[model samples]
Target: MLGAPLLEEASGIGALGIDLTSLLVYLINFTVLGLILYFMAYKRIIGMLDSRSERIRESLEEADRVRKESEEQQESMQKALDDGRQEGQRVLAEAREAAERYREQQAEQARAESEQIVSRAREEIKQERDAALESVRAEFAVLAVSAAEKIIKRSLDADAQQDLIDEVISESNAKQEQD
Candidate 1:
């Protein structure tokens, strides 16, 4: 009687069209296929993704380094340009100083030359004045001798004449000194 209840339960499960052996076989096949695909394709796909990520990271680092180098180059170029401008200004200032010195020297030279010309002209005038004074003194002595001869109304010897001329000249020099 116990076996009869067991057979009845088995028939009832069969009536629902369920096969336990085929279900176990299909489960085993699906598990084996999933494991094979994981081993062969999944690992390679993950490795490819990791390698691509590493390449992208390296490219970004290279771009950052290049940007830093370009910034450094630009700073150096600006410094060089500033230095060039300073050097040009210094050279221009030196040139201006040199020109000013040249102008001063030329002016001083002209002044010295003019002074020399003026000094020469003054010396010439003094020499001419002395010569004219000497000529006037000689003519005055001759006129005095002639006037004396007319006042005496007589001819004198050469010694007397010379003595008289010497006296008259001394008297004239005394009068000029008193005046």
Candidate 2:
């Protein structure tokens, strides 16, 4: 029964103009061509593609590393700039403080010198006043002696005149002190 179905199938294919031996030869040729192409060209093309892919990956990684390093350098530069600004401010503050201290010292020295000058002037005035008072007292005593000699109308002994003048000067001094 299987032989009969095969014969019928073969006859059907023959009516359609199909030759089995030629079809087999064509299939064998196609398989051989495919295998040759895979060995000769396909593997080399795949290897080249793989190498290119690896190079692209490495380039990407290197670019990322360079970018990170650049960022770190920029941060360091910024930090240095900030520190410099702070140092400048600190120096300026110190200079201002020193100037203020110098001004205060100069003021204090000027005040001390002025006080000393004023004290000397007052002492000189007091000494001049005392000298003027002594001169007036001596002139008054001489005038009193001349008046007493005229009243008496006689030349008194030198000792009596001297004693009289001393007594008058002492009385005046005592009165002045009481007043």
Candidate 3:
């Protein structure tokens, strides 16, 4: 009779296995709730962060492009300014050289004109001096002839008279030259 009751107690041992199955179902429910929360909250936050990062990257790229263009423009402008300054200096130097050449030419012309004027004045002075000396010689000869005619008390009478007057005039001229 004791062995027969012991076998019946052994059959009730399978009821403890049902408790483990119920614990497994509760673990599956907890895992599903955690996944739902992540999809609703954390996914939207990650999307917002990604869009903001893209905008910032594009803005930075545009700024870099603008800066590069500005530098290129400045370099070209600087080169143009330098070229203009060099051209201006070249023009100024050319102008100064031309001015100097013109001045030299003018000075040479003035000197030539002055020489011509002096030469003309000298020629005129020589001519006047010759005329004055000739006039004085003519007057002296007339006076000497008049004085001799008065002293002789006679008029010239042809060939003999001409011969005597020539001899006397030539001798007097010679003595005057010697003295």
Candidate 4:
């Protein structure tokens, strides 16, 4: 009966077409092929991937550095523009102040010159008035002497004539003062 059960189990396995020896051999060959492929190409592929990743990291770092430098340059340019505008305004203000000063100086000089001209004209008029007064006085004296000579019809002594002329002149001056 034991041999009979063993024979029946073997017949069942044969009916299923399952062989232990063939399964074992297939497992061994698959393991060896996997190991060979890993040794031949796996390390080189991993190395290439690592190098590419490092290159990408370096490129990103360089781009960041360039962006920072560009920002700094923009700030510097803005500062320079602001300073130039302030300087231009200052220069314009100074120029305006200088022009105002020059105008004031010119006006003052013109006023001084005009005053001098008026003073000179006044002095000239005064001199002319004095000369005319002297001429009239001399003419009046000549007329008085001629009238006295004609009224008297006789030659008077020089001292007596001079006294008469002095009395007449003093009386006329007194009359003018009272009026």
Candidate lDDT (C-alpha), each: 0.80, 0.83, 0.75, 0.79
Leading candidate by TM-score: 4
Superposed model 4: Cα runs more than 4 Å off: 1-55, 136-179
Which pairs of residues have clashing backbones in candidate 4? none
lDDT of 3: 0.75
16: Cα error in model 2, Å: 15
lDDT of 4 by residue, 2-121 (tens): 334322355445755466887899999898887887787777778788998999998899899899999998999999999999999999999999999999999999999998999888
lDDT of 3 by residue, 43-158 (tens): 87778788888888888998998899999889889999899999999999999999999999999999998888898888888888767655665665566556767888776666
Best by lDDT: 2
Expressed as tens digits, the lDDT of each residue in 1-179 for candidate 2 is: 33343233544446454668878999999999989989998988999899999999999999999999999999989999999989999999999999899999999998998888888888888888878766776777778888878988877798988888888888877876798
Candidate 2 residue spans exceeding 4 A from truth: 1-77, 150-156, 175-179
Rank candidates by lDDT, best first: 2, 1, 4, 3
Superpose all Cα atoms of candidate 1 onto the true structure and report the RMSD in Å to 1 decimal. Answer: 8.2
Can you give the TM-score per candidate against the true fold?
0.51, 0.51, 0.53, 0.54
Give the lowest summed-lDDT range of ten residues in model 3: 2-11
Q: Give RMSD to native, each candidate.
A: 8.2, 7.5, 10.2, 7.7
Candidate 1's displacement at residue 39, Å, is 5.9
lDDT of 1 by residue, 64-166 (tens): 9999999998999999999999999999999999989999998999899888888888888888876775566667777877777788787788888788777
